[model samples]
Target: MSSPSTLSPWRLSVAPMMDWTDRHCRYLHRLLTRHTLLYTEMVTTGALMHGSELRHLRFNAEEHPVALQLGGSEADELARAARMGERWGYDEINLNCGCPSERVQRGAFGACLMAEPQTVADGVKAMRDAVSIPVTVKHRIGIDKTESYEFVRDFVGTVADAGCEVFIVHARNAWLQGLSPKENREVPPLRYELAYRLKQDFPQLTVAVNGGITTNAQIAEHLRHVDGAMLGREAYHHPWLMTTWDETFFGDAPAQRSRDWVEDEMVRYMERAHAEDGCPWYAIARHMLGLRHGLRGARKWRQVWSDHRLKPLPPREVWAMAQAHVCNESDVLVA
Candidate 1:
C-alpha cells in the first residue's frame, strides 16, 4: 500500500529465480510481505526485444517495488531493455550475472560474464545511462575454482564504477562446465565472508548476500555484515517465512494478515482471476501450496488444493475443502 520508493532498496529481497518468481508468484509474495523487494524471473534481452512486450513486461500494480532482471551481455541491447523496464514502471532494473545455466552461457551472458567484468560494466553503464531507476547487478562470487576474493572484489569495483550502487552477491562460485543449473546451486560452496568483505571494501555500495540464506535468524546475521539478504528456493518452498519479515527485519508492526486471512484473500484472488481473465485456478493455486508449510495438516491442505479433480469446482469450494484439513471441527461444521 505504501510507495516502493520510500522503502529501503537492499534491506531484504527475493531472488530472481528462472522458472519461479513469475508475476503470479510475486503477487503471492507481495501479499505476505509488503516491504521485501521482489524480482521478476530473468528475462533475456532477446526475449524482451523480440518477444511480446505485454506478455513479458505486464505485472500487477500490487507487485510494486519489483525489479526486472535482465540477462544479456550487449551494452546497447541491455540499455534498450532497461528503458522498457523503466517505462513499465519497475522500481529497479537488475542485470543477471549469477545464473549458471548452460543456456544462459550460450547466450554469452549470465555467470560467464563474470570473466568479462569490463563488458558487464559497459552494459551496466549503458543501462544506467538509459534509465533513471536504480540499476543493480546480481552475480556470483567467482567462476569455477577461482577462490581469490580479488576476482569478485574487482568485478564489484568495476561495476560500481559504472554507476551500479547495489550488488546482490550470490556467495558461491558458478561452475560453468561440469554442473547442471540445479547442481550449480547446490554443489558450489557458499563463502559468505567474501560478500561481507565486499561490503567492508566498498562501504559506499549497497551489498546484499544471497545463496544458502533460509531463515530470519540467518538474515539477521547477514545484515550485520552486508546491506541485505536475498532468499531464493527457501522463500518459494516455505513462503510463510516472508510473512514475518516486515516486522522482524524492517521493524514494522506485526503482519495484519493471519494465515487464515491470507488464505481467504488468495481465494478472492483466484475468484477474480477466473472471472476476469479465465485464468485457471491451478496456475495461481500452485504458488500458495507452500503457504501452510510446516503446519499441522499442511500436506493434506496442499493435496486438496492440488487435486486436479477439483478444477470443475469454484475456487471458493476448493478453498473450503482445503480449509477442512486445517480448520477445527467447529469451523468445518460451520462451513
Candidate 2:
C-alpha cells in the first residue's frame, strides 16, 4: 500500500456532488471501493476561509485518498484553502469552475469562468504553488449554447500550461441562464466525444470524463481513451456498483462482505460520530439508505430507520434496527 498521495494518480474517482458527497456518504463509498479516490462536496472558499475550521474541514481517517473540492476565483483565498485542506489530510485539492448555479455566477465563478480561463489558470497555479499534493480542476465543455469542441480543448490547454496535470471534464454545456443547478446536471446534452478528443490533443494531461456515465462498463470503455472517469448521480443512486471498483480498478481481492456486514462497519462510524459533539447518527445514516438497494426488505429497512422512532434512539439502538435485516434470530437477540 502506497500512501494516498502516491496511489491517487493510478485510480478512478467519484465526483464531489453538492448535497450528496458529505462525510457520511464518503464513508459509505469507501466500503464499496477501497482504492478509487473520493471527493467532498464543493466547499466554498469563503466558508473554508471564514467559517469554523472544525466544521468545514473535519473528516474521518477512513476517507483517506479523498480530495477536497473548493469553489472560488481568488488566487490567494484558494491558495489559503488549499493549505488548510492539506493540513487536514486531504490527498488532493480541486478547483470547481464547472457548476452552473446562479449563486455561483453571482460570485463571479463557476461555468461562467470558462470564458475567463486566464483567471482560472491563476487560481490553479496559486493552489499548485501552495501545495505539493496534486492540485486539479473540473470544468464543463462549454456554457449556454456555445458548443464548439475547441472551446474545451482550449480550456484544457490553458489550464495545463498553468501546471494543472489532472482535468475532470464534465462533457456537457451549461446553460448558465435558464437551467437551474439540478437541471444543469441533467438537461445538458452529454458530449463524451469532445472529452475523448481532449485526451488526444493534450496527451500529457490526465483527462477524466464525467456526466451521464452510470455503469462500470461505461467507465471501463471511457478509460480506454481518457485517463479516468467520475460518477455523480449514478454513484449516489446505485451505490452498490462501487462494491466492485476495488477489485476491478485497483486489483484488490474482491470483498465478500454482504450488505449486512457493511452495515456493521457503520457502527464504528456511529460511535465516532456520537463522540464528536454537534454530529448526529441520522446525518450520516441518511446517505447509507441506498446501500442496500435491490436487497430483500431493503425498503423496510429504509422506512424503519427513517421513522421518527429511531431519531432519538442512541447509536446502539439505531445500529440494532439497521442490522435487523441481516442478523439471524440468535444474532439479533445477542446484539
Candidate 3:
C-alpha cells in the first residue's frame, strides 16, 4: 500500500466488468497496452470472506497497476476486503457503487448504495484506515429517476470528506427497479458534462468519466476535462484499440508486437495453460475472438479459431487454420 501520488496515473483504465475482465482477459489486455490500468471483475466481500479466496483474488504479475473492485456495503466488511486486496499486491482498491444488477442490489451494495452517501463514506473511511493503498469509489451520476446534479455532487463531497481521493463517475443513471443492467447502460443517456463539472467544482479531487466513450478521440476529449477515461465493453470487444493506447494516451513507446505476433504469443500461452494448468484452449480463445476485428477476412479467421472441432488439436493447429484462411482471402483479393 502506498500514497495516491505513488500510484500510476489513471489516465486510461478498463472498467471492472463481471464475467469479462477475468485474469486471463487482463493478461491479454496487458500484452497490448503497457500503461492502461486494468480492473478485476467486482468481487464481493461475502465471496472473498466465505468463498475460495485464491480463486477470487489471484492474478498474474504482468497485470501490474491493476485495481481490485469490491462490492459490499458494510464498513467493516469492505475494510477487511480492501486489506486483503492490498495483501494480494493490488495497486488500488475500488468500491463499486455503480452496478445496477439485481444480484448486486440483493447484496445491499452497488448503485443502491448511492442513496446512502454517508454509509458509502463510512465504508470509504474504514477501507482507507485499513489499507495503505489508494481507496477509490465508482458510482453513477444519479440513481433511479434523480437527475439533479446536486445529488452526485453531494455524494462526492461526503465521500471525499471520508478520505477517498479518486472518483470514477459513470456518466449515467442507474435505475434500480424495472431496468436490467444492460438497459441501464443503454437507456440512460450519457451526461459527460456532469463528470466534467465534478472536476471543475472539486479541483482537488481526481474525477474520471465512464460510459458511452468508444474511440480514442472521445478519450482525448474527456481527458481535457477529467483525470481519466475508463472503457468498458468497447475495450474488451475491440482489444486492438488498446494496442496503441500506451503511445497515444500515456506517451509510452509504441507497442512492438504486430497482430500476428500477439496471436502467436496467445497460442504459446494457451499451450502452456493446457500443459501445466489443464485449461482448455477454447476457454482462452474466446477472449481473443475480437482480435482480428475489422481486418480483411477477419470473420472467417475468427470462425476457424472458434471451431470446437479444433479443440482436440493443439493451439498451433488452430493458429495455422486461421492464418491459412486469411492468406486464402488475400490471394483471392489479389486476383
Candidate 4:
C-alpha cells in the first residue's frame, strides 16, 4: 500500500460532510475500499484551539489517507490548526471555502472566503509553511450568482501560487442568503464545465470535481475531464458503490468479500469501541445501515440494526438478530 503522498490520493474520495463522515463512518468506508481518500468533517480552527483535541482529531488507524478539513479564514489560526492536524498524523490539511450556511458566514469563513482570494492564498501559504504535509482547498465554482468562470479561475490561480497542489471544486454556486444549507445543495445549478476548464488552464495542478456526481459512470466521465471526482450524499446513502471503485478506478483486483463480512468486521469494531470508551453500538451501527443496499432482505436487515427497542442489547446480539434475516431463520427479533 503506497502512502497517499506516493500516489494520487484525490482520484476517488468521499466528501467531508458535516455530521456524517465521522470516525465511525470513515472506518466503515475504509473497510469497503482500501484506496479511496477519506475526509474528516469540517473542524473549525476554534474547535481545535479551544476544544478537546482528542474529540476533534481522533480517528481509527485504519482510515489512512484521510485529510483533515479546517474551516477558518485567519492565516495564523489556519496554520496552527494545520500543524495540529499534521502532528496528529493526518495525511493532508484541507481548507474549506465552499460551505454556505449562515452560521459559517457569521464566522467569516466558508464560501464567503471565495470573495477574498488573497486571504485564502495567505492562509494556504501559512499552512504550507507550517506543515510538511500537503495543503489543499475545497471551494465552489461561484458564490451567490457570480457565475463568471473568471471568478473561480482566479481563485484557483491565486491559491495555486501559494504552493497548494490539490483543489477540489464543487461545481455549484453557493447562495449565501435566503437559502438554507440543504436548499443550497439542491438549488445550485451544476457547472462541471468550469471545473474542467480549471484543469485545462492550470495544467500543473490536480483538480477534482464534486457536486451532483453519484454513479460510477459519472465518476468515470468526470475523470476524463478532471483529475478526480468526489461523492457526497450519494456515497453516504449507497456506499456499496465504493466496493467497486478500487477495481474500476485503480485497477485493483475485486475484493473477495460480502456485505456480511463487512458487517461482521464493523461488529468487531463496535464491540471494541464500546469496551474502550462505553461508546454505544447504535452509534457505530448507524453508519453501516446502507451496507446491504439494494440486496435482498436489506430492509429487514437495516430495520433490525436500527431498531430503537434493541438499544440495550449488545452489538453482537444485534448482529445476530440482523444476520438471522439473511440466513432465512424466522425466529429472530424484528423491528
Candidate that scores best on TM-score:
4
Error of 2 at 307 (Å): 1.2
| Model 2 Cα lDDT, one tens digit per residue, 170-252 | 99899999888888888989999998998888888888989998888998899888988998888887788898887676666
Clashing pairs in 1: none
Candidate 3 ranges with C-alpha deviation above 4 Å: 1-8, 327-335
Superposed model 1: Cα runs more than 4 Å off: 1-7, 328-335
Whole-model alpha-carbon lDDT for candidate 1? 0.90
Tell me the deviation in Å of residue 15 in model 2: 1.0
TM-score of 4: 0.95
TM-score (C-alpha, index-matched) for candidate 1: 0.94
* Winner on lDDT (1 vs 2): 1
Output the lDDT of residue 287, model 2. 84
lDDT of 1 by residue, 75-133 (tens): 99999999999999999999999999888988999999999999999999999999999
Q: Scored by CA lDDT, what does every candidate get?
A: 0.90, 0.84, 0.91, 0.92
TM-score for each of the candidates: 0.94, 0.93, 0.94, 0.95
lDDT of 4 by residue, 1-335 (tens): 44434657799999999999999999999999998999999999999999999999999999998999999999999999999999999999999999999999999999999999999999999999999999999999999978999999999999999998999999999999989999888898999999999999999999999999889999999998999999999999988889998888887887887777888999999999999999999999898888767666778999999999999999999999988767432333354
